[model samples]
Target: MSSARWIYLDAGRGLAALVVVHHHLMVFFDHEMAALIGDESLLLRAFRGISEWNVTAILFFFFISGWSIFLAVERLGTLNGIGPWRLYLLQRARRILPMFLLSLLWAGGLSWAGERNFNDTSFDVLVGNLLFLDTPASLRGLWFPPFAGNGPLWTLSNEAWYYISLPVFYWAVYSKIANPLVRIDAALLGSFVVGIAAIGVNAILPNPFFLFATLWPLWIAGYVYGTSFGQTPIERRVIFWLGLMALVTWSMALEIRSDTLRILSDGCILALCVVLLVKIVRWQTQLTRLHYIDGIVRLFGSVGRGSYTIYVLHYPLLLFLASSRTELGGLATSLLGMGMLIAIAPHLETRIYAHVNQWFALDRPRADA
Candidate 1:
């Protein structure tokens, strides 16, 4: 990765994480939320109008994930052998599991200490959380919200599964199939068809069990984004924009009569938004002369480097802060959580995730230089 080219990406990741933080932090402030309800400022009104409907932050994350997997493909040159796939899975696990276990232990311990209910969580639920198998939507049907102490981590299950399945995807979509057009065609067709099947299953079954089926399109789109990243072409982005608009228009055309269709349409829009976001930002940074904007991006990018840890650990931290009722109150405590994350990320990343990721890297010889 060219540092200049990817600064926006890191900055974007950081910004997406910040947005989620800000949204959750606002949950602590009754007055602030009430003010939004009564807000008259046009700018704030517009911000709320978009922000309220924008579930695109997490969607962008998945896009970035796909892109990341693509980079692995480019450098590693596909998982043609079992040994490469084993290293790939090991690297992913080591990168995620250590810190994940730390957070889970902390949260689980706190829950038991506070409630004196060590028996509250069952093996399946705990296993599901540890493995990223259970989602809030899925657990909600079973009346198991409390077990999902860190709700955001639920997406990790999707990511984990995606990571595991990526080699197969690499082989089927990009590797074993030599024809590029055929690969894209197969991916698009298979992903959408499976996604439709998932929607049907989702209609009848509890969510997240078939979550991958529902979100295959978005992940594939992310893969496309990664493969296409930094290729300076206007038409690719233009096509993505058109596809996004078409999905939005189609959703509106139907007026959201069926909930399943509504979600599928939303997923399509979100997937495109992910691609458009990276594309537009990269384009902007390239065209702009503003040094200050670059500096700001660098700052956010710095904070964003630890965004995953922040995202995973924030829920528990927020809960602790709120329950402690520090003189700082909710908003300040929430902000404090951000500060703690920024401070902690460098250490955790250097000592943990980055090292593992680097060690597991497939194209290390080329990357090291």
Candidate 2:
């Protein structure tokens, strides 16, 4: 791995992955939570507000993935020794496919035990998911009768689809477009413009899920913005403040079913992407008394080494917990549960990948320096 590249992208992925965990925590933990928040208590109101806007976290993943992939290609291309494509694909297969398949079985089993009628009607959709074709339709139901019942899988499918298609997309922008800088500029400008247009169109058609399709352009925007605009000191600070402002503004705004607000929210997410990208480039993290927090981040990053497993396996575990309803000792219980999953997931994920590689005969590739 390129040490410089690894430093930021790994750290960014670490943040994005944690956001995913936090987003899910809000979902699973929020039960009669609105009532618990006393009318006058600002703290409880803030907590409720964060949980309601949890979807934004997944969008962060999409943007980061785009930026990271572009940089990976750029660096590897410059180095001239690494087989970027091979390395990328091997890692992708190891990280994504095994866990995805395992989750299918796990979810299927849970469905059986719970006596929840698993509709196999959308066999085509299942196949689509199996191949990541479902990504473009990520917000839609997985199976006709909502067989899997895991909303997160859609993003995974979207992620897989992005990985599968990125080579062609990268080549188009980086090679076929003739001027890399120009293409990057267009991608950056076009994503927000098109995103707003999409929102307008969706308002007429009412595709709440149509926004999932924006993942592609949002990602490409990050890629373009990173490649074309180097992280200058002033730019970094500006982007950080802009991102923070957007987050704060969005948090303060009341919910209104207006396309304008949706567009603004998307823009805010774009800004946040810029901030995170700049932060990684700066690498100015101070080691405070948050050693435990640091350790948790480090642990999650390691488990994120095989996050595909955790992502895939986690829903079933959560479903079981939800279904069983065995008394978890409140907020502490939720944290502990997530902690245990983080601890075990990495090891099990690696083992599962080993078997997957063997089964697929994927271990024979010689790493050509």
Candidate 3:
């Protein structure tokens, strides 16, 4: 990757990391701070609004992930035929499995350390979390999860599912299929139809699994852009404009429909991301330094570089906040928590990942993975 591309990745990854932090903070500390800060305060409402958009941020990250991965495939395809499928899976597992296990253990340990009752339900949660299975619907609210334990692991599972399934997508849509564009179009159309069907079922059945199907478009969109990244500046510009429009339309939809709209909104946002990423790759400029802002972005990026580690360790910290005696102010608590994580991220990457990697036999030197 070019230095410019690294800069773009750093910016997005930093923003994603901070959003993940805020998402956890809102669940753990925001509610407590609301009463303390003033129940009817505008500041509280503002915080609440941002909190509600955490899922949107997560969806954006997924979109970016898709775009990045597709670009990788494109780059590789020109060289050695994109290598072997088994090697790809092994690399992905090495990348994700260490962090996933650590997060699970972090959750289990928090339950023990915080003196939370680890009943039969807790045991089941540990297993479910470890296996990346859907948490029993019964435990959904047993404890607030976003900030507490490995709640973020849910996304990891989705990501893993996507990674594992990519080969099939490549074969079915982009490679083996006689007409790749037609296959892409058909897949997207079928996914949207499925999403609409899920919405219908959700009206009576309330199954959120339906939402998982919606991610197909985002993943495919990312693949398409990634495949085309180095083709030409004009083509890149086309993707960029399309992505921008998708984002604008999605934002407008958010105002129009809160429930069902997110389904389509996310799809549009995913497509928009591909375009935006293509533009970034083609047109690059350095940010004029804004003293503290640059410093903070760099710090966030440093922590984000070990996103896997920070993500794994973050839940335990949340559980600590939820169960501990400290009654921290919202802003103060959030800043402190982030500061600690920023400080600890390097340590986790260095020492903790090693410990977690033992079981998975994933302690390969960072460069190899």
Clashes of each: 0, 0, 2
The estimated TM-scores of all candidates read 0.80, 0.68, 0.72
lDDT per residue for candidate 3 within 114-149, as digits (tens), equals 756333335555555555454223221122222234
lDDT of each: 0.61, 0.55, 0.58
Worst 10 residues of 2 by lDDT: 137-146
Identify the leading candidate in terms of TM-score: 1
Cα deviation of 14 in candidate 3 (Å)?
Answer: 1.8
Cα error, candidate 2, residue 11 (Å): 4.1
Candidate 3 regions exceeding 4 Å error are 31-49, 71-83, 118-121, 135-149, 177-211, 230-264, 270-274, 277-299, 327-335, 350-369
By lDDT, who's the top model here?
A: 1
Model 1 lDDT tens row, 1-369: 644545565676777777766655655554555564556767555555545542567766766666556655565544667877887676566656766777677677655554334333676777767656666543322223324366676667777778777777777777667755456566666666776677666656755657555666677666766655655563375344438544653655396454445655766776666556656766786788768877889888886777777677776666655556557565566677767776887467555655555665532211100
* Candidate 1 runs further than 4 Å off: 1-6, 32-54, 113-120, 138-148, 230-264, 277-292, 326-328, 354-369
> Model 1: which ten-residue window has the lowest total lDDT?
360-369
